[model samples]
Target: MCAEPGHYKPLDAPVGPEPVAMVPVVQLYARDVPGLAFPAGTDLLQILWCPLVHEDDQYAANPRLLWRSTELTAAGTAAGEPPRPHTVEEDYLPRPCTVSPTAAVEYPNGDLPEELADLLDERFDDLKEKQGYCYFEVATTQQSKVGGYPGWTQPPDWPHCAGCGTRMEHLLSVTATEPGMGRWLPLDDRDPRQGISAAPSWQAEADPAALDTFGHDMCLGDLGGMYFFVCRACPGTPYTHRYDC
Candidate 1:
């Protein structure tokens, strides 16, 4: 699909690279995250992006977000397969997988209040002794999730609303890496620390799928993550995003 399109379509791009169709990144309904607010009368949130890097736009995929009402799209009027991009960054593409939402609590990676941080440091040590698990290692989630602290690999960069000038609420995080090894590893997989005391223990033959691949496997710039934001106070629910490693 590296060739030009058969049909022509209007574009808003200036003199730049040839325009190409954007691909579906993700689609979510109100039912998926009941606590999250949706625009008035809209029950669905659809996200698509150009699967190519944009240096001007934080050197990451240029994502476009849309809010839709499911009741409005009649079954017959629903479109067929979407047009594919003629040129795409293969590393930006994600594998098709069913989303099974799970409820969880995670400690913040970067946004702990100063006073709370003092208390948390003391509590972390106590919890590690009692639970035999580092709270940061076991409780913090650095994977894709809805309505929780973003597992930032770097310092936090929260965006403010352009329309109202208030700090935007973090909607979700789309990360390149998901939970795999360490205390956060799935119970179904054999513990990397369980086998004999040997070097290269993590690679000592167990759950090939775990080591062979990564969650979604998208090249998000040194295992970074994209944080979506929204201003619920503004009309149309104006949104923005922040990306970091």
Candidate 2:
């Protein structure tokens, strides 16, 4: 008997080096990502990645971003049998989840020098105290989103594509959490009583003196984000990746 169309069949046994599967966690269209200037002709962005890390990078799984032309791909067929490597890190395996992109405003953490940060902190102390939220927290909050970098740092100076000298455009951000900051917690999910007052509890449970922060701990040892850029000029060319905290 033949299997039903679209039904996935597991292999009887494992094959070569465990193939890390690339699964789609989210899909964003040009409209979904505001402020980002996607190149013309590219309207769809697909974020996919292997949950497990490759042998070279033990810190985080590899993420792939594909800038697609929906009009050109609307009739494309789905693969019947995706590659499955034999061995994979069990810890890196991701539980299947879908994402709904939400537009958010973010500021670069590095944008403010220490002096400016201190000044702002002092200026906002009264409001922070009254609102029970810090200036930094307020400045960094982003709505629920997956795979987008915090504007904590200046936008990367993307290198020119090697194949074509076109300046690459930021395609997607692979992040562990939708919104890494606690302040960005959705209004429905936010607890009015849990800002500074909850710090003690959070600290107590945190990894001893380590760079433990929400969302950051899920990936590499540090709380940073990975960014991917594509050479829109060369549509079929490979993309480049960059990392930052």
Candidate 3:
């Protein structure tokens, strides 16, 4: 399972070697090809060569024809180092990792309280079809919303936690969910009280001390793609009124 949480699992495999980081496919264009397939176990500095072949030929036109090895030629093995072998294992599926929901916490699910399970099912269908991957999208009604200051919204400096007075730096990871799960979770580590507000006034109501203070009352929606959670330690804010509306 790729790390994160609240994800859906299709099949289980004994943990193998740590997964290899793939080159981002978004950078590739249709007309272009990867300089060479960086097969498993290939070193970074190795020079790979691609072999050219004719569509059909019983025998080589020239006796001196050479077949290329997928492994990088320049990649050298130190003393007692085994030569890296090239293997083309194309069985791995590409999907975004899933973030698991907080265990044992009750979600305020209204119409379908068990919707989270259903969301996982939908994600599985998408993965089977290879449609696309899902990341955390803020729900319209999650209790606490994540926040960040403009221009520097990359966490630590941006998304601050009011409870521990700490910036959410570490990702308490979860499992990889199936594609299209649509199970965006609340960023509970950041906020567990479920009192995040989109408006400054709502925040003021949540924390009346902020009424005369300089802090801004930001909501989770402002932080693009972040799921917010409320802090239990500092339940200073009242239950947000906007959740029911």
Q: What is the lDDT for 74 in model 1?
A: 46
How accurate locally, in lDDT, is each candidate?
0.67, 0.49, 0.24
Off by over 4 Å in 1: 1-16, 74-79, 179-207, 210-215
TM-score of each: 0.77, 0.56, 0.15
Which residue pairs overlap in candidate 1's backbone? none
lDDT value, residue 182 of candidate 3:
17
lDDT of 3 at 40: 34
**Residues forming the 10-long window of minimal summed lDDT in candidate 3:** 58-67
Candidate 1: tens digits of C-alpha lDDT, residues 95-192 = 66545555666667577777887878988889879866666554557767778887777877888889989988988888876544322334334446
lDDT of 3 at 191: 31
How far in Å is the alpha carbon of 29 misplaced in model 1?
A: 1.8
Candidate 2 wrongly placed segments (more than 4 Å) = 1-19, 34-36, 55-58, 79-81, 90-92, 142-172, 178-181, 186-224, 229-239, 243-245
- Report how far residue 87 has shifted in candidate 3, in Å: 14
Candidate 2 residue 46 Cα shift, in angstroms, is 1.7
Comparing 1 and 3 on TM-score, the stronger one:
1
Candidate 3 stretches with Cα past 4 Å from truth are 1-9, 22-245
